[model samples]
Target: MSEPLYHVSANPHVRDNGSTQKIMLDVIIALLPATIFGIYIFGAPAAKTIVITIVTCVAAEYIYQKLMKQPVTISDMSAALTGLLLALNLPPEVPFWLPIIGGVFAIIVVKQLFGGLGQNFMNPALGARCFLLISFAARMSAFTYDGVTTATPLASLKAGESVDVLRMFEGFIPGTIGETSAILLIIGGIYLVARKVISPIIPCVYIATVAVFVTLFGGHGVDIQYIAAHLFGGGLMLGAIFMATDYVTSPITNKGKVIYGIVLGILTGLFRLFGPMAEGVSYSIIIANILVPLIEKVTMPTPFGIVKGGKSNE
Candidate 1:
Protein backbone atom coordinates (compact mmCIF):
# COMPACT_ATOMS: atom_id res chain seq x y z
CA MET A 1 0.00 0.00 0.00
CA SER A 2 3.08 2.23 -0.13
CA GLU A 3 2.76 3.15 3.54
CA PRO A 4 -0.66 4.76 2.84
CA LEU A 5 1.05 7.63 1.02
CA TYR A 6 0.45 9.98 3.93
CA HIS A 7 3.03 11.72 6.10
CA VAL A 8 3.04 13.72 9.31
CA SER A 9 4.43 17.22 9.47
CA ALA A 10 6.45 19.00 12.14
CA ASN A 11 5.18 20.07 15.52
CA PRO A 12 3.26 23.32 16.20
CA HIS A 13 0.07 21.37 15.58
CA VAL A 14 -1.94 24.55 16.13
CA ARG A 15 -1.67 27.79 14.21
CA ASP A 16 -2.77 31.33 14.98
CA ASN A 17 -5.61 33.29 13.38
CA GLY A 18 -3.34 35.24 11.07
CA SER A 19 -2.03 34.43 7.61
CA THR A 20 0.02 36.51 5.17
CA GLN A 21 -3.02 37.05 3.01
CA LYS A 22 -5.21 38.17 5.90
CA ILE A 23 -2.56 40.44 7.33
CA MET A 24 -1.88 42.01 3.99
CA LEU A 25 -5.58 42.44 3.44
CA ASP A 26 -5.89 44.17 6.78
CA VAL A 27 -3.01 46.45 5.91
CA ILE A 28 -4.64 47.40 2.61
CA ILE A 29 -7.84 48.21 4.46
CA ALA A 30 -5.95 50.20 7.06
CA LEU A 31 -4.27 52.25 4.37
CA LEU A 32 -7.58 53.27 2.82
CA PRO A 33 -8.46 56.23 5.06
CA ALA A 34 -5.12 57.91 4.60
CA THR A 35 -5.12 57.20 0.88
CA ILE A 36 -8.59 58.63 0.42
CA PHE A 37 -7.70 61.68 2.45
CA GLY A 38 -4.61 62.13 0.29
CA ILE A 39 -6.60 62.10 -2.91
CA TYR A 40 -9.01 64.62 -1.47
CA ILE A 41 -6.16 66.89 -0.50
CA PHE A 42 -4.08 66.55 -3.67
CA GLY A 43 -6.77 65.84 -6.26
CA ALA A 44 -6.46 63.75 -9.44
CA PRO A 45 -2.71 63.81 -9.74
CA ALA A 46 -2.32 61.97 -6.45
CA ALA A 47 -4.76 59.25 -7.52
CA LYS A 48 -3.00 58.76 -10.85
CA THR A 49 0.41 58.39 -9.18
CA ILE A 50 -0.86 55.73 -6.80
CA VAL A 51 -2.46 53.75 -9.60
CA ILE A 52 0.65 53.84 -11.75
CA THR A 53 2.95 52.81 -8.94
CA ILE A 54 0.79 49.88 -7.93
CA VAL A 55 0.34 48.62 -11.48
CA THR A 56 4.01 48.87 -12.24
CA CYS A 57 4.96 47.06 -9.06
CA VAL A 58 2.54 44.21 -9.62
CA ALA A 59 3.53 43.86 -13.23
CA ALA A 60 7.20 43.91 -12.41
CA GLU A 61 6.87 41.22 -9.77
CA TYR A 62 4.80 39.04 -12.05
CA ILE A 63 7.17 39.38 -14.97
CA TYR A 64 10.28 38.77 -12.88
CA GLN A 65 8.93 35.57 -11.34
CA LYS A 66 7.77 34.32 -14.74
CA LEU A 67 11.16 34.92 -16.29
CA MET A 68 12.89 33.08 -13.47
CA LYS A 69 10.42 30.15 -13.68
CA GLN A 70 9.44 30.70 -10.03
CA PRO A 71 5.94 30.49 -8.69
CA VAL A 72 4.18 33.84 -8.77
CA THR A 73 3.66 35.43 -5.37
CA ILE A 74 1.64 38.42 -6.45
CA SER A 75 -1.49 36.88 -4.97
CA ASP A 76 -0.03 37.65 -1.54
CA MET A 77 -0.61 41.38 -2.16
CA SER A 78 2.65 42.38 -0.48
CA ALA A 79 3.87 43.95 -3.67
CA ALA A 80 0.74 46.00 -3.89
CA LEU A 81 1.20 47.24 -0.35
CA THR A 82 4.80 48.16 -1.03
CA GLY A 83 3.82 50.01 -4.18
CA LEU A 84 1.09 51.96 -2.44
CA LEU A 85 3.40 52.88 0.42
CA LEU A 86 6.07 54.07 -1.99
CA ALA A 87 3.58 56.18 -3.83
CA LEU A 88 2.24 57.66 -0.61
CA ASN A 89 5.72 58.70 0.40
CA LEU A 90 6.25 60.58 -2.84
CA PRO A 91 5.39 64.17 -3.63
CA PRO A 92 2.33 64.74 -5.83
CA GLU A 93 4.37 66.60 -8.41
CA VAL A 94 6.92 63.81 -8.90
CA PRO A 95 7.62 63.01 -12.54
CA PHE A 96 5.48 60.15 -13.86
CA TRP A 97 8.44 57.99 -14.74
CA LEU A 98 10.00 58.51 -11.33
CA PRO A 99 7.38 56.40 -9.57
CA ILE A 100 7.63 53.67 -12.20
CA ILE A 101 11.37 53.52 -11.67
CA GLY A 102 10.95 53.46 -7.91
CA GLY A 103 8.36 50.70 -8.16
CA VAL A 104 10.68 48.58 -10.28
CA PHE A 105 13.49 49.09 -7.81
CA ALA A 106 11.26 48.09 -4.93
CA ILE A 107 9.77 45.00 -6.56
CA ILE A 108 12.94 43.81 -8.23
CA VAL A 109 16.09 44.91 -6.43
CA VAL A 110 14.88 45.10 -2.87
CA LYS A 111 12.19 42.39 -2.88
CA GLN A 112 12.17 39.69 -5.56
CA LEU A 113 15.93 39.49 -5.90
CA PHE A 114 16.20 38.78 -2.17
CA GLY A 115 14.00 35.65 -2.55
CA GLY A 116 10.72 37.39 -1.84
CA LEU A 117 8.37 37.63 1.12
CA GLY A 118 9.86 37.68 4.62
CA GLN A 119 13.40 37.59 3.28
CA ASN A 120 13.94 41.23 2.33
CA PHE A 121 16.58 42.97 4.47
CA MET A 122 14.78 46.30 4.65
CA ASN A 123 11.31 47.58 3.99
CA PRO A 124 11.22 47.60 0.18
CA ALA A 125 9.07 50.69 -0.04
CA LEU A 126 11.31 52.69 2.25
CA GLY A 127 14.40 51.49 0.43
CA ALA A 128 12.94 52.62 -2.86
CA ARG A 129 11.86 55.95 -1.37
CA CYS A 130 15.34 56.56 -0.02
CA PHE A 131 16.83 55.76 -3.39
CA LEU A 132 14.49 58.18 -5.10
CA LEU A 133 15.24 60.83 -2.51
CA ILE A 134 18.94 60.49 -3.19
CA SER A 135 18.77 60.27 -6.96
CA PHE A 136 16.21 63.00 -7.53
CA ALA A 137 16.65 65.44 -4.73
CA ALA A 138 15.08 68.26 -6.71
CA ARG A 139 11.90 66.36 -7.54
CA MET A 140 11.64 64.79 -4.10
CA SER A 141 11.94 68.14 -2.35
CA ALA A 142 9.60 69.98 -4.67
CA PHE A 143 6.13 70.09 -3.11
CA THR A 144 2.99 71.12 -4.99
CA TYR A 145 -0.82 71.30 -5.00
CA ASP A 146 -3.08 71.58 -8.04
CA GLY A 147 -0.10 72.38 -10.26
CA VAL A 148 1.01 75.24 -8.02
CA THR A 149 4.32 75.03 -6.16
CA THR A 150 4.51 75.51 -2.42
CA ALA A 151 6.90 74.90 0.45
CA THR A 152 6.38 71.78 2.52
CA PRO A 153 5.53 72.32 6.15
CA LEU A 154 8.86 70.85 7.12
CA ALA A 155 10.65 73.12 4.67
CA SER A 156 8.86 76.12 6.10
CA LEU A 157 9.78 75.11 9.60
CA LYS A 158 13.40 74.57 8.61
CA ALA A 159 13.49 77.94 6.86
CA GLY A 160 12.22 79.61 10.05
CA GLU A 161 8.85 80.53 8.52
CA SER A 162 5.84 80.53 10.78
CA VAL A 163 3.15 77.86 10.15
CA ASP A 164 -0.39 77.49 11.35
CA VAL A 165 -0.85 74.26 13.24
CA LEU A 166 -4.52 74.18 12.39
CA ARG A 167 -3.79 74.21 8.65
CA MET A 168 -1.27 71.42 9.01
CA PHE A 169 -3.82 69.26 10.78
CA GLU A 170 -6.44 70.09 8.16
CA GLY A 171 -4.19 68.85 5.34
CA PHE A 172 -3.53 72.19 3.65
CA ILE A 173 0.21 71.62 3.79
CA PRO A 174 2.22 70.77 0.67
CA GLY A 175 4.02 67.49 1.22
CA THR A 176 3.76 63.83 0.27
CA ILE A 177 0.25 62.62 -0.46
CA GLY A 178 -0.32 60.71 2.79
CA GLU A 179 1.96 62.84 4.97
CA THR A 180 -0.08 65.98 4.75
CA SER A 181 -2.80 64.93 7.18
CA ALA A 182 -1.40 64.21 10.59
CA ILE A 183 -4.87 63.64 12.00
CA LEU A 184 -5.77 61.02 9.41
CA LEU A 185 -2.47 59.21 9.80
CA ILE A 186 -2.94 59.04 13.56
CA ILE A 187 -6.40 57.61 13.18
CA GLY A 188 -5.10 54.90 10.86
CA GLY A 189 -2.19 54.10 13.19
CA ILE A 190 -4.54 53.77 16.15
CA TYR A 191 -6.70 51.40 14.14
CA LEU A 192 -3.73 49.18 13.28
CA VAL A 193 -2.68 49.03 16.95
CA ALA A 194 -6.22 48.34 18.09
CA ARG A 195 -6.57 45.51 15.59
CA LYS A 196 -3.35 43.96 16.96
CA VAL A 197 -1.67 44.27 13.60
CA ILE A 198 1.25 46.13 15.25
CA SER A 199 2.70 46.63 18.72
CA PRO A 200 2.04 49.93 20.44
CA ILE A 201 5.38 49.87 22.23
CA ILE A 202 7.38 50.98 19.20
CA PRO A 203 5.07 53.84 18.30
CA CYS A 204 4.69 55.04 21.87
CA VAL A 205 8.37 54.84 22.75
CA TYR A 206 9.56 56.31 19.45
CA ILE A 207 7.20 59.27 19.58
CA ALA A 208 7.82 59.96 23.26
CA THR A 209 11.59 59.86 22.84
CA VAL A 210 11.41 62.30 19.93
CA ALA A 211 9.12 64.60 21.90
CA VAL A 212 11.35 64.63 24.96
CA PHE A 213 14.62 65.01 23.03
CA VAL A 214 13.25 67.88 21.00
CA THR A 215 11.97 69.58 24.14
CA LEU A 216 15.37 69.31 25.82
CA PHE A 217 17.73 70.33 23.02
CA GLY A 218 15.83 71.45 19.93
CA GLY A 219 16.17 75.15 20.95
CA HIS A 220 14.94 77.82 23.34
CA GLY A 221 12.18 78.57 20.83
CA VAL A 222 11.13 74.91 20.80
CA ASP A 223 8.14 74.36 23.08
CA ILE A 224 6.36 71.20 24.22
CA GLN A 225 3.63 71.83 21.66
CA TYR A 226 6.25 72.14 18.96
CA ILE A 227 7.61 68.77 20.02
CA ALA A 228 4.08 67.39 19.83
CA ALA A 229 3.77 68.98 16.42
CA HIS A 230 6.87 67.11 15.31
CA LEU A 231 5.37 63.88 16.48
CA PHE A 232 2.04 64.39 14.71
CA GLY A 233 3.49 66.04 11.66
CA GLY A 234 5.08 64.56 8.50
CA GLY A 235 5.77 60.84 8.17
CA LEU A 236 6.44 60.08 11.85
CA MET A 237 3.16 58.20 12.34
CA LEU A 238 3.40 56.37 9.05
CA GLY A 239 6.99 55.24 9.55
CA ALA A 240 6.57 54.26 13.20
CA ILE A 241 3.46 52.22 12.52
CA PHE A 242 4.32 50.71 9.16
CA MET A 243 7.97 50.83 8.15
CA ALA A 244 9.58 50.38 11.58
CA THR A 245 7.23 47.56 12.48
CA ASP A 246 7.83 45.60 9.25
CA TYR A 247 8.14 42.05 10.55
CA VAL A 248 11.04 40.96 8.36
CA THR A 249 13.27 43.95 9.13
CA SER A 250 12.42 44.61 12.78
CA PRO A 251 13.61 42.84 15.94
CA ILE A 252 11.63 39.84 17.18
CA THR A 253 12.56 39.89 20.85
CA ASN A 254 10.62 42.22 23.17
CA LYS A 255 13.68 43.87 24.67
CA GLY A 256 15.20 44.38 21.26
CA LYS A 257 12.01 46.00 20.06
CA VAL A 258 12.12 48.61 22.79
CA ILE A 259 15.75 49.36 22.09
CA TYR A 260 15.06 49.60 18.39
CA GLY A 261 12.25 52.04 19.02
CA ILE A 262 14.38 54.22 21.28
CA VAL A 263 17.29 54.37 18.86
CA LEU A 264 14.97 55.16 15.97
CA GLY A 265 13.36 57.95 17.97
CA ILE A 266 16.69 59.53 18.90
CA LEU A 267 17.99 59.40 15.35
CA THR A 268 14.81 60.91 13.99
CA GLY A 269 14.92 63.75 16.53
CA LEU A 270 18.57 64.48 15.82
CA PHE A 271 18.04 64.55 12.08
CA ARG A 272 15.08 66.88 12.34
CA LEU A 273 16.84 69.20 14.78
CA PHE A 274 20.31 69.17 13.27
CA GLY A 275 20.07 67.80 9.72
CA PRO A 276 18.99 69.91 6.78
CA MET A 277 15.84 67.90 6.16
CA ALA A 278 12.76 68.66 8.21
CA GLU A 279 11.72 65.01 8.65
CA GLY A 280 13.75 61.97 9.70
CA VAL A 281 11.39 59.05 10.22
CA SER A 282 12.37 57.16 7.08
CA TYR A 283 16.09 57.52 7.70
CA SER A 284 15.72 56.56 11.35
CA ILE A 285 13.73 53.42 10.54
CA ILE A 286 16.25 52.33 7.89
CA ILE A 287 19.12 52.78 10.34
CA ALA A 288 17.31 50.67 12.94
CA ASN A 289 16.48 48.04 10.33
CA ILE A 290 20.19 47.47 9.75
CA LEU A 291 20.72 46.78 13.46
CA VAL A 292 17.83 44.33 14.02
CA PRO A 293 19.92 41.18 13.64
CA LEU A 294 22.47 42.34 16.19
CA ILE A 295 19.74 43.53 18.54
CA GLU A 296 18.01 40.14 18.37
CA LYS A 297 21.21 38.27 19.22
CA VAL A 298 22.04 40.40 22.25
CA THR A 299 18.51 40.27 23.63
CA MET A 300 17.75 36.63 22.87
CA PRO A 301 15.56 34.89 25.46
CA THR A 302 16.96 32.08 27.61
CA PRO A 303 15.74 28.60 26.79
CA PHE A 304 13.98 26.40 29.31
CA GLY A 305 16.13 24.24 31.65
CA ILE A 306 19.25 26.06 30.52
CA VAL A 307 21.68 28.09 32.62
CA LYS A 308 23.48 31.20 31.38
CA GLY A 309 26.47 29.16 30.17
CA GLY A 310 25.33 25.53 30.40
CA LYS A 311 23.47 23.11 28.17
CA SER A 312 19.99 21.78 28.88
CA ASN A 313 19.37 18.18 30.06
CA GLU A 314 17.35 16.28 27.51
Candidate 2:
Protein backbone atom coordinates (compact mmCIF):
# COMPACT_ATOMS: atom_id res chain seq x y z
CA MET A 1 0.00 0.00 0.00
CA SER A 2 0.40 3.45 0.84
CA GLU A 3 2.94 5.11 3.13
CA PRO A 4 1.87 6.74 6.37
CA LEU A 5 1.40 10.49 6.66
CA TYR A 6 2.54 12.84 9.40
CA HIS A 7 0.69 16.03 10.14
CA VAL A 8 2.23 19.05 11.84
CA SER A 9 -0.27 21.92 12.04
CA ALA A 10 -3.71 23.13 11.04
CA ASN A 11 -2.21 26.24 9.52
CA PRO A 12 -0.22 24.45 6.86
CA HIS A 13 0.31 27.40 4.57
CA VAL A 14 2.44 29.42 6.99
CA ARG A 15 6.03 30.14 6.07
CA ASP A 16 5.18 29.21 2.47
CA ASN A 17 8.66 29.94 1.24
CA GLY A 18 10.40 28.30 4.17
CA SER A 19 11.07 24.67 4.95
CA THR A 20 12.38 23.49 8.27
CA GLN A 21 15.83 23.11 6.76
CA LYS A 22 15.68 26.53 5.18
CA ILE A 23 14.44 28.31 8.30
CA MET A 24 17.13 26.64 10.36
CA LEU A 25 19.74 27.66 7.86
CA ASP A 26 18.57 31.25 8.17
CA VAL A 27 18.91 31.01 11.93
CA ILE A 28 22.43 29.68 11.57
CA ILE A 29 23.34 32.44 9.17
CA ALA A 30 21.85 35.08 11.45
CA LEU A 31 23.70 33.68 14.42
CA LEU A 32 27.06 33.58 12.63
CA PRO A 33 28.06 37.18 13.32
CA ALA A 34 28.03 36.92 17.11
CA THR A 35 29.51 33.43 17.01
CA ILE A 36 32.37 34.49 14.77
CA PHE A 37 32.94 37.68 16.75
CA GLY A 38 32.99 35.60 19.90
CA ILE A 39 35.54 33.26 18.41
CA TYR A 40 37.62 36.14 17.17
CA ILE A 41 37.76 37.46 20.70
CA PHE A 42 38.06 34.12 22.46
CA GLY A 43 40.19 32.30 19.88
CA ALA A 44 40.62 28.55 19.14
CA PRO A 45 39.05 27.28 22.34
CA ALA A 46 35.73 28.87 21.49
CA ALA A 47 35.70 27.46 17.97
CA LYS A 48 36.64 24.01 19.23
CA THR A 49 33.90 24.04 21.84
CA ILE A 50 31.30 25.07 19.28
CA VAL A 51 32.39 22.41 16.76
CA ILE A 52 32.41 19.64 19.37
CA THR A 53 28.99 20.64 20.64
CA ILE A 54 27.44 20.67 17.17
CA VAL A 55 28.98 17.31 16.28
CA THR A 56 27.85 15.70 19.52
CA CYS A 57 24.31 17.05 19.23
CA VAL A 58 23.92 15.86 15.65
CA ALA A 59 25.39 12.48 16.55
CA ALA A 60 23.09 12.11 19.52
CA GLU A 61 20.00 12.73 17.43
CA TYR A 62 21.19 10.34 14.74
CA ILE A 63 21.93 7.56 17.19
CA TYR A 64 18.68 8.01 19.13
CA GLN A 65 16.51 8.01 16.03
CA LYS A 66 18.35 5.06 14.52
CA LEU A 67 17.90 2.92 17.62
CA MET A 68 14.28 3.92 18.08
CA LYS A 69 13.29 3.47 14.42
CA GLN A 70 12.18 7.09 14.13
CA PRO A 71 12.65 9.25 11.05
CA VAL A 72 16.14 10.69 10.89
CA THR A 73 15.95 14.48 11.05
CA ILE A 74 19.56 15.53 11.24
CA SER A 75 19.24 17.36 7.95
CA ASP A 76 16.56 19.69 9.33
CA MET A 77 19.35 21.53 11.20
CA SER A 78 17.46 21.87 14.49
CA ALA A 79 19.97 19.73 16.29
CA ALA A 80 22.83 21.76 14.93
CA LEU A 81 21.11 24.97 15.96
CA THR A 82 20.57 23.65 19.46
CA GLY A 83 24.22 22.70 19.65
CA LEU A 84 25.31 26.10 18.43
CA LEU A 85 23.08 27.98 20.86
CA LEU A 86 24.17 25.82 23.77
CA ALA A 87 27.83 26.29 22.89
CA LEU A 88 27.36 30.02 22.63
CA ASN A 89 25.82 30.13 26.10
CA LEU A 90 28.77 28.27 27.57
CA PRO A 91 31.84 29.87 29.09
CA PRO A 92 34.55 30.21 26.51
CA GLU A 93 37.02 28.41 28.75
CA VAL A 94 34.70 25.53 29.50
CA PRO A 95 36.21 22.08 29.25
CA PHE A 96 35.94 20.23 25.94
CA TRP A 97 33.76 17.55 27.47
CA LEU A 98 31.32 20.12 28.83
CA PRO A 99 29.81 20.87 25.44
CA ILE A 100 29.92 17.18 24.55
CA ILE A 101 27.77 16.34 27.56
CA GLY A 102 25.62 19.43 27.06
CA GLY A 103 25.03 18.51 23.43
CA VAL A 104 23.92 15.04 24.35
CA PHE A 105 21.61 16.37 27.05
CA ALA A 106 20.10 18.94 24.70
CA ILE A 107 19.38 16.47 21.92
CA ILE A 108 18.60 13.33 23.88
CA VAL A 109 17.04 14.51 27.10
CA VAL A 110 15.47 17.84 26.23
CA LYS A 111 14.48 17.37 22.60
CA GLN A 112 14.17 13.69 21.67
CA LEU A 113 12.69 12.42 24.90
CA PHE A 114 9.94 15.01 24.65
CA GLY A 115 8.97 13.76 21.17
CA GLY A 116 11.39 16.10 19.44
CA LEU A 117 11.33 19.61 17.96
CA GLY A 118 8.08 21.57 18.40
CA GLN A 119 6.86 19.08 20.96
CA ASN A 120 9.37 20.12 23.60
CA PHE A 121 8.01 22.53 26.21
CA MET A 122 11.16 24.64 26.50
CA ASN A 123 13.98 25.66 24.21
CA PRO A 124 16.35 22.69 24.03
CA ALA A 125 19.51 24.73 23.91
CA LEU A 126 18.49 26.95 26.82
CA GLY A 127 17.29 24.01 28.84
CA ALA A 128 20.65 22.35 28.35
CA ARG A 129 22.45 25.55 29.31
CA CYS A 130 20.57 25.75 32.61
CA PHE A 131 21.20 22.07 33.22
CA LEU A 132 24.93 22.44 32.70
CA LEU A 133 24.97 25.63 34.70
CA ILE A 134 23.39 23.90 37.66
CA SER A 135 25.50 20.77 37.35
CA PHE A 136 28.77 22.61 36.82
CA ALA A 137 28.33 25.98 38.38
CA ALA A 138 32.02 26.58 38.86
CA ARG A 139 32.99 25.84 35.30
CA MET A 140 30.01 27.68 33.92
CA SER A 141 30.74 30.83 35.87
CA ALA A 142 34.48 30.97 35.21
CA PHE A 143 35.51 33.40 32.47
CA THR A 144 38.99 34.15 31.17
CA TYR A 145 40.61 36.44 28.62
CA ASP A 146 44.25 36.53 27.66
CA GLY A 147 45.15 34.09 30.47
CA VAL A 148 43.47 36.29 33.10
CA THR A 149 40.14 35.47 34.67
CA THR A 150 37.53 38.12 35.48
CA ALA A 151 33.95 38.58 36.42
CA THR A 152 31.35 39.45 33.83
CA PRO A 153 29.99 42.95 33.59
CA LEU A 154 26.78 41.92 35.22
CA ALA A 155 28.66 40.48 38.15
CA SER A 156 30.65 43.63 38.53
CA LEU A 157 27.52 45.70 38.28
CA LYS A 158 25.88 43.64 40.97
CA ALA A 159 28.81 44.30 43.29
CA GLY A 160 28.24 48.07 42.96
CA GLU A 161 31.34 48.50 40.85
CA SER A 162 31.85 50.51 37.70
CA VAL A 163 32.18 48.74 34.35
CA ASP A 164 33.71 49.96 31.12
CA VAL A 165 30.46 50.88 29.44
CA LEU A 166 32.09 51.48 26.07
CA ARG A 167 33.94 48.15 26.15
CA MET A 168 30.82 46.28 27.18
CA PHE A 169 28.99 47.71 24.19
CA GLU A 170 31.92 46.82 21.96
CA GLY A 171 32.04 43.17 23.23
CA PHE A 172 35.36 43.52 25.01
CA ILE A 173 33.78 42.77 28.35
CA PRO A 174 34.03 39.30 29.89
CA GLY A 175 31.00 37.15 29.21
CA THR A 176 29.79 33.91 27.62
CA ILE A 177 30.70 33.11 24.03
CA GLY A 178 27.81 34.81 22.23
CA GLU A 179 26.50 37.20 24.88
CA THR A 180 29.28 39.76 25.06
CA SER A 181 28.53 41.57 21.83
CA ALA A 182 25.41 43.71 22.06
CA ILE A 183 25.81 45.27 18.62
CA LEU A 184 26.37 41.97 16.83
CA LEU A 185 23.49 40.33 18.68
CA ILE A 186 21.16 43.15 17.72
CA ILE A 187 22.38 42.92 14.12
CA GLY A 188 21.59 39.22 14.03
CA GLY A 189 18.18 39.87 15.53
CA ILE A 190 17.52 42.53 12.92
CA TYR A 191 18.47 40.09 10.17
CA LEU A 192 15.96 37.55 11.42
CA VAL A 193 13.23 40.17 11.68
CA ALA A 194 13.99 41.60 8.24
CA ARG A 195 13.94 38.13 6.70
CA LYS A 196 10.51 37.52 8.28
CA VAL A 197 11.92 34.61 10.19
CA ILE A 198 10.74 36.17 13.49
CA SER A 199 8.49 38.93 14.74
CA PRO A 200 9.95 41.92 16.56
CA ILE A 201 7.17 42.09 19.15
CA ILE A 202 8.65 39.93 21.87
CA PRO A 203 12.18 41.32 21.70
CA CYS A 204 11.01 44.90 21.60
CA VAL A 205 8.62 44.57 24.50
CA TYR A 206 10.97 42.38 26.51
CA ILE A 207 13.82 44.85 26.29
CA ALA A 208 11.53 47.81 26.80
CA THR A 209 10.05 46.30 29.91
CA VAL A 210 13.48 45.70 31.36
CA ALA A 211 14.46 49.26 30.57
CA VAL A 212 11.42 50.62 32.33
CA PHE A 213 11.83 48.32 35.32
CA VAL A 214 15.44 49.25 35.92
CA THR A 215 14.59 52.89 35.51
CA LEU A 216 11.83 52.70 38.06
CA PHE A 217 13.82 50.60 40.50
CA GLY A 218 17.07 52.42 40.00
CA GLY A 219 19.73 51.66 42.60
CA HIS A 220 21.64 54.83 41.90
CA GLY A 221 18.79 57.16 40.95
CA VAL A 222 18.06 55.78 37.47
CA ASP A 223 20.61 57.03 34.97
CA ILE A 224 20.68 56.26 31.25
CA GLN A 225 24.16 54.76 31.55
CA TYR A 226 23.00 52.33 34.23
CA ILE A 227 20.02 51.34 32.15
CA ALA A 228 22.22 50.81 29.13
CA ALA A 229 24.62 48.74 31.19
CA HIS A 230 21.75 46.54 32.35
CA LEU A 231 20.50 46.29 28.80
CA PHE A 232 23.79 45.47 27.08
CA GLY A 233 25.43 43.60 29.90
CA GLY A 234 25.21 39.83 30.42
CA GLY A 235 22.65 37.95 28.30
CA LEU A 236 19.73 40.39 28.26
CA MET A 237 20.33 41.35 24.65
CA LEU A 238 20.85 37.77 23.51
CA GLY A 239 18.01 36.33 25.55
CA ALA A 240 15.51 39.07 24.74
CA ILE A 241 16.27 38.99 21.03
CA PHE A 242 17.04 35.33 20.36
CA MET A 243 16.43 32.80 23.11
CA ALA A 244 13.06 34.13 24.24
CA THR A 245 11.79 34.21 20.69
CA ASP A 246 11.92 30.46 20.01
CA TYR A 247 8.90 29.64 17.84
CA VAL A 248 8.01 26.42 19.64
CA THR A 249 8.36 27.87 23.12
CA SER A 250 7.01 31.40 22.68
CA PRO A 251 3.44 32.53 22.22
CA ILE A 252 1.88 32.37 18.75
CA THR A 253 -0.64 35.19 18.82
CA ASN A 254 0.42 38.83 18.93
CA LYS A 255 -1.53 39.56 22.11
CA GLY A 256 -0.17 36.45 23.75
CA LYS A 257 3.36 37.43 22.82
CA VAL A 258 2.95 40.86 24.37
CA ILE A 259 1.87 39.35 27.66
CA TYR A 260 4.70 36.85 27.49
CA GLY A 261 7.26 39.59 26.92
CA ILE A 262 6.00 41.64 29.81
CA VAL A 263 6.12 38.68 32.15
CA LEU A 264 9.64 37.83 31.08
CA GLY A 265 10.82 41.36 31.72
CA ILE A 266 9.24 41.50 35.14
CA LEU A 267 10.70 38.16 36.15
CA THR A 268 14.13 39.06 34.83
CA GLY A 269 14.09 42.35 36.65
CA LEU A 270 12.97 40.73 39.88
CA PHE A 271 15.62 38.07 39.66
CA ARG A 272 18.40 40.53 38.98
CA LEU A 273 17.35 43.05 41.60
CA PHE A 274 16.27 40.68 44.39
CA GLY A 275 17.35 37.13 43.62
CA PRO A 276 20.88 36.02 44.36
CA MET A 277 22.04 35.98 40.77
CA ALA A 278 24.00 38.57 38.89
CA GLU A 279 21.80 38.07 35.83
CA GLY A 280 18.49 36.33 35.24
CA VAL A 281 17.88 36.16 31.49
CA SER A 282 18.14 32.36 31.34
CA TYR A 283 15.79 31.83 34.24
CA SER A 284 13.43 34.48 32.95
CA ILE A 285 13.21 32.92 29.51
CA ILE A 286 12.68 29.45 30.94
CA ILE A 287 9.94 30.73 33.22
CA ALA A 288 8.26 32.54 30.35
CA ASN A 289 8.47 29.44 28.17
CA ILE A 290 6.70 27.44 30.83
CA LEU A 291 3.84 29.95 30.96
CA VAL A 292 3.35 30.37 27.19
CA PRO A 293 0.45 27.93 27.15
CA LEU A 294 -1.42 29.92 29.78
CA ILE A 295 -0.76 33.22 28.07
CA GLU A 296 -1.96 31.90 24.74
CA LYS A 297 -5.02 30.37 26.31
CA VAL A 298 -6.05 33.61 27.91
CA THR A 299 -5.19 35.79 24.93
CA MET A 300 -6.49 33.47 22.20
CA PRO A 301 -8.48 35.26 19.55
CA THR A 302 -12.24 34.88 19.11
CA PRO A 303 -13.71 33.99 15.76
CA PHE A 304 -14.58 37.16 13.88
CA GLY A 305 -17.74 38.83 15.29
CA ILE A 306 -18.80 35.67 17.09
CA VAL A 307 -19.89 35.00 20.66
CA LYS A 308 -18.91 32.08 22.95
CA GLY A 309 -21.96 30.08 21.81
CA GLY A 310 -20.99 30.55 18.14
CA LYS A 311 -23.63 33.14 17.45
CA SER A 312 -23.04 35.53 14.56
CA ASN A 313 -22.59 39.31 14.89
CA GLU A 314 -26.29 39.81 14.13
Question: Per-model C-alpha lDDT, please?
Answer: 0.83, 0.89
TM-score of each: 0.92, 0.94
The Cα error of candidate 2 at residue 148, in Å, is: 0.7
**lDDT tens readout by residue for model 1, 1-314:** 46566666422121468767777777878788888988998888899999999999999999999999998989978899999999999987677999999999999999888888777888999999999999998998888866789877776776777777777776777889887777777787788788788778887788888887888877745675566567767888788877788878888677888999899989998899899889888888888888988998889988888867768855
Give the worst 10-residue stretch by lDDT in candidate 2.
8-17
Steric clashes per prediction: 0, 0
lDDT of 1 at 179: 78
Off by over 4 Å in 2: 1-13, 309-314
